[model samples]
Target chain A: MTNELALAALGDPTRRTIFECLSDRPSAVGELAQLLPVSRPAVSQHLKVLKDAGLVVDQKVGNRRIYRLDPNGIGDLRDYLERFWGCALTTFKMKSEQKGQE
Target chain B: MTNELALAALGDPTRRTIFECLSDRPSAVGELAQLLPVSRPAVSQHLKVLKDAGLVVDQKVGNRRIYRLDPNGIGDLRDYLERFWGCALTTFKMKSEQKGQE
Candidate 1:
């Protein structure tokens, strides 16, 4: 479920930029929108997508909501990617074994 | 490029299952289709999606196309997930720094 959400969330280039922007520090939608080419509401929409994807978390800091990366969701993606490597290694070994027979 | 393709390739559950089937060893579309709930043509289509995603490759073996995982594309996914961890740690440190200031 998390993987599905994450893959969908990260499927877009604009959303990826917004998500990556918070990597340095958490920021308000307006602040982030300033750096991005998209409008403020579009950034807000992207934030919602990231939130749904389980890739970001937000908190009310007085009047504005500050967005930050969600470590758990990120961990899930990392684990997903890790499995791909395992698949690769297994495939690699099987090929090597076949080569040995030949 | 590979990340986009890999994400799109893995976005589907049916394709994911078919790709996972080849994790143990390469197999023909018919053999994989037997293990899957989908039809042989469906399996062939899934393999084609995986191939386009750069997630899997195929070779003709005795008139059958044997599909295997592509390691380079997998490495790209692994590297993509690895960046999320970097983002996480950076966000963690920034939060810690803010807490210390407060």
Candidate 2:
């Protein structure tokens, strides 16, 4: 469920940018808003979606909340892709061997 | 461009399902449609989006077109996620060390 949610959460362009920025380092909504074209409230909305998707988590630092990528959620996605990667490689090798046989 | 397009393409549930099926093996539209709830034309439409995103490829096999997941496009997406994984791991180590010092 988290994998599907994470994929849906990242479907939006703004959310992807926010995720990328947070990937670099944690930041508050104001900081993200400053870096992006969108407003602070918009950034907050996107963050909420990411948080709900389990792709992001926030911690209170002083008076502000800092957002960062959740490695666990990312790990789930990575595992999913890794399965496909391995499958593709196996299929490629089999195809090559079959071609050699022919 | 391909990365973003691939992300957007897979963002759709149906397209993701089709991609997953192709991950197992290549199949024609009728074969995919039989396994899916969608119609043959619908499967073709989703395949078109996947192809346009560079996430899927097709070849003429007899009278039918066989579709398969494109390893190159999947590789691009894998590369993108690997970067984030490395960054997250680095941050995790740094934070863990800081906590150890504290």
Candidate 3:
């Protein structure tokens, strides 16, 4: 998924809460529901969006599916932000130099 | 602005494009319109959202308003992603240990 999709997925407060819950530990839908104020179905729906955004993944652990944060997704977001940071610093430096010249 | 607001503000493709443009250089609304496919008013609208999200800041440069990326906003996004990365690593280590025990 694109970084935009990931950002959009995490844009929701409920989804961010669900993502934070999974960050602490891998969990099943029922467990996530218990941790969050949302219902089981709501958790499931949020999970679907998170999965589509590549922010989380699921693995079948016996009869239950476990969800956990995807490192790659987080890495993508970091990279995207880092790019902007680098550019911002560069622009800042350029502006500073121009001021110094003035 | 909250990170959620920033994320939601960047969720739109047009806003992201406008953000990318700003990263390259500070520009006025007319300049951004020239650089992007969108109209000056559309760029203005996107800039307002970006400003509200703390992703960008504007300063009056004579008769024009210049827009540029805000380092703090980029830093906030990086910090948010890094948190997920740290938790993911910790969870991975714990899962590995459990597997080893099993």
Candidate 4:
């Protein structure tokens, strides 16, 4: 469920951009807004979705909230992809052997 | 660009479902339609999108086209995720040290 939500949240182009930005380094909403073409409020909304999906986490720094990519979430997403990677490779090997027999 | 296309291709819930099906094992349009709630035509459409994104490959078996996960594309996507994983970890370590200093 968490992986599905993370995937769904990243389905949006803007959200993906925001995610990539966070991966580069942690930043506040204003910084993200400056980096992207979207407005501050739009960035905030995207961050909210990301947070809800567990893809990002925010820290209270002074009066602002700094956002960064959540390592645990990224690890889960990576593991999900890795599982498919293994499955695909196994299928490929089986297909190749079957083709050899044909 | 390729990774972006792949990500956008998988943004849809139906597309993700189709991808998961392919990962389990290669199947034809009819088989996929049977397993999924969507119609045969819908399955075909989703396969087209997946193919266009380089996420799937099809083989002509007799009169049927069998669809399977493209290992190359999966490798690319895995690499992309791995890159972010490394970046996030590095950032996490840095943040911890910085916090220690404060």
For all candidates in order, the CA lDDT equals: 0.80, 0.85, 0.82, 0.85
Arranged by lDDT with the best first, the candidates are: 2, 4, 3, 1
What does DockQ come to for candidate 4?
0.53
lDDT of 2 by residue, A3-88 (tens): 77788887889998998899888999999999999899999999999999888999999999999888777877778767746788
Sliding window of 10 residues with minimal summed lDDT for model 2 chain A: A76-85
TM of each candidate vs. truth: 0.77, 0.88, 0.82, 0.86
Off by over 4 Å in 1: A34-39, A90-102, B37-42, B90-102
TM-score: which is higher, 1 or 4?
4
Query: Which portions of model 4 show Cα errors greater than 4 Å?
Result: A93-102, B93-102
Question: lDDT tens string, model 1, B1-102?
Answer: 768767767767787777677777778888998998878998888888788878888898888888888877777676775764585766666778999999
Candidate 2: TM-score?
0.88
Please give the range of 10 consecutive residues that has the lowest summed lDDT in model 4 chain A: A76-85
The CA lDDT at B27 in model 1 is 88
Q: What C-alpha RMSD separates each model from the true structure?
A: 3.7, 2.4, 3.5, 3.3
Write one digit per residue (lDDT tens) for candidate 4, span A1-102. 788788888778899889888877789999999999979999999999899888999999999999988988877877776774687877777878999999
Predicted model with the maximum lDDT: 2
Alpha carbon lDDT at B52, candidate 2: 88
Per-candidate DockQ vs. reference:
0.44, 0.57, 0.58, 0.53
Q: Candidate 1 vs candidate 2: which has greater TM-score?
A: 2
Q: Going through the candidates in order, what is chain B's TM-score? A: 0.82, 0.87, 0.83, 0.86
**Per-residue lDDT of B4-53 in model 4, one digit per residue for the tens?**
77887877889988888887778999999998888999999999988887
